[model samples]
Target: MSFDTPDDRKYLESHEWATTDEPIRIGISDFAQDELGDVVFVELPDEGDTISHDEPFGVVESIKAVSDLYAPVSGEIVAVNDALHDQPELVNEDPYGDGWLLEIDPSDESEFEELMDADEYEAQIA
Candidate 1:
């Protein structure tokens, strides 16, 4: 399946998406979920757990395979979408919105600058 990288969201070559906000919400990209096939399980970090940029934070299990979910910015996890435990397919159906995996109150704002813009990320997957 092909995925369109949204111009509004910054991306990682690892196939995660990020945006700057009070608490950054992170999730697998549409491209990622499409490639992984139907999602079956999602393991996200607990609230208050600290994570570093580009580091593994959790796992996304799809019918095809299991992939590590990475932190786009170093920070403390503030929340996770608990709904995913019952409906993992949300990651495949709506990776950007309701399917979001976690939220982090960042350790440092500068870390978000390291993420790739949509244009650069499009070139990466192309």
Candidate 2:
């Protein structure tokens, strides 16, 4: 099935997508939330937490399965989606906007540059 993948963001092979805007906002892709069926819970890194590129940073639990949330770039987490704790379905409802997981101050700009662009991400998922 086709999924919404905004042209403004870059994506990881693990199905996480990151915004090109400042502070590096991130979340799971539309295809990911759909595959998970319904998200029941989300465990997020605390603000100020240090996360490494391509490393597991948190977890997203769904009725069908639980998945590790990987960081697409190395950075210090600046903000987290507090709303997800009470409303995990937002991940499925709006994966790119209100459902965004974290905002980071990237340690490596080169890493964000390496993440798959929208077209490349769609091709990968296809």
Candidate 3:
């Protein structure tokens, strides 16, 4: 099945996606939510927490399995999707929009550029 691999963001092989916009938004890919089935819980870092590129930042638990959420870039987490605490289904319903995991103030913007583009991400998933 085709997934929404938006060009405005970069992707990790682990299936996380990070936007290039300011206060860079981060989330799992549409493909990942689909693969995981219904999301039941999300364990996220509190705002102000520091995360490093390729490091585990949180957990996404689904009906099918629990998965670790990794950082696509190193930075301070400025915001987290508190909505997920009460409405985990949002991840399955809108993985790219309201389902976004967190926002970061990147310490190294260059890390984002180093991640795979949409085409490369799509190809990896394909």
In model 2, where do residues sit more than 4 Å from their true spots? none
Task: Name every residue pair that clashes in candidate 1.
Answer: none
lDDT digits (tens) for residues 67-103 of candidate 1: 9988888898889899999999999889998899998
List the global CA lDDT of all models.
0.87, 0.93, 0.95
lDDT at 26, model 2: 91
lDDT of 2 by residue, 21-111 (tens): 7899999999999999989999998999999999999999999998999999999999999999999999999999899999999898899
lDDT of 3: 0.95
Instruction: Please report the candidate that would top TM-score against the real structure.
Output: 3
Residues 1-126, model 3: lDDT tens digits: 899989999999999999998899999999999999999999999999999999999999999999999999999999999999999999999999999999999999889777999999999999
- Candidates 2 and 3 compared by lDDT, better number: 3
The C-alpha TM-scores of every prediction are 0.95, 0.97, 0.98
